[model samples]
Target: MAEGFLTTHVLDTARGIPAQGVKITLYRISGMSHRKIAEAVTNADGRTDAPILPKGTFRPGTYELVFHAGDYLRASGQAGDGVLFLDEVPIRFGMAEDTHYHVPLLLSPFGYSTYRGS
Candidate 1:
């Protein structure tokens, strides 16, 4: 098996730019339990300086990426004073094989998208 790892990036679809300063949390979920495993904050390029789960640390299992987008939306002047429609976006997925998993977030004030990337 090839080395396995996990990474992520954030794109602001509405502004058409990288989303900086977005907080991300990784959770390892098993049955009814969710354990916090890692945390990262996006930099100027909307990417973590390092992989959230690096080689030798990554495993095939159920995971969740919680993107704190409300802070970014408010900081970018996109969110209104009322409650946000997309605040903490939780994307739950499974890594079935040992390879590379890039789960990116395409974010906007009202919605978001994510997928398995290269």
Candidate 2:
């Protein structure tokens, strides 16, 4: 059987560029427990150098991806030093054991969207 993996990317919708240097954290959620599984930072291409959840380590369960957007917004000049409207953005989802998941984020200063991609 083919094992699954998880990956993500960020795009700066307002600036029409790839969001670089964004911090990404992965968590495995079960019942009332949230356990951090992995962490990554987006490179210049708006993607991590490696998969957040590699194929061999994949499992079927609920997961969450936390994108630290406030820092990136400030550094990219999309936001000020003041408190941001959107700080840490969290997307909670479930995955099957045998499907590759590509979660892409289309982000702006005040709004963001995510979808399962190819």
Candidate 3:
């Protein structure tokens, strides 16, 4: 059994390595609104092997993953001005069953992208 229901990873393309200490926030979508779910940080490997959602709290609905790009870049010693163009990265998706949702971010100074992964 999974301890949580959501997961993510972050790769700093500019640095060509896994991004550590990136702040990630999870949210639950409610009709036309959103509710905060949980937050976590990426490990040294740039991955969250455990679920982001609280244990035994899995449900079917839309969710969002907000990545703090600017903060991460700055913390990693990159200049804040114009560095890491994307300030906040938000990824919204849905869950249908008790399954693993791994969202990995491939990021650079001027751009970033993510997708559903195994």
Backbone clash pairs for candidate 3 read: none
Residue 112 in candidate 1, Cα distance off native in Å: 0.8
Instruction: Pick the TM-score winner.
Output: 2
Q: Per-residue alpha-carbon lDDT of model 2 for 1-118, expressed as tens digits?
A: 4479999999999999999999999999999999999999999999999999998889899999999999999998888888899989999999975879999889999999999998
lDDT of 1 by residue, 1-118 (tens): 3489899999999999999999999999999999999999999999999999888887789999999999999999998778999999999999988998999999999889998999
State TM-scores per candidate.
0.96, 0.96, 0.86
**Which regions in candidate 2 have their CA more than 4 angstroms from the true location?**
none
Candidate 2 vs. true structure, TM-score: 0.96
Ranking by lDDT: 1, 2, 3
Q: On a 0 to 100 scale, what is the lDDT of residue 95 in model 2?
A: 94
How well is each residue in 1-118 modelled by candidate 3, as lDDT tens digits?
A: 5444777899999889999888899899989898987888888999765678855888878998999888987777765666455789899888877777778899886788888888
RMSD (Å) per prediction: 1.4, 1.1, 2.4
The Cα error of candidate 1 at residue 83, in Å, is: 0.6
Alpha carbon lDDT of each predicted model:
0.94, 0.93, 0.82
Candidate 1: give the clashing pairs: none
User: Which regions of candidate 1 are displaced past 4 Å?
Assistant: none
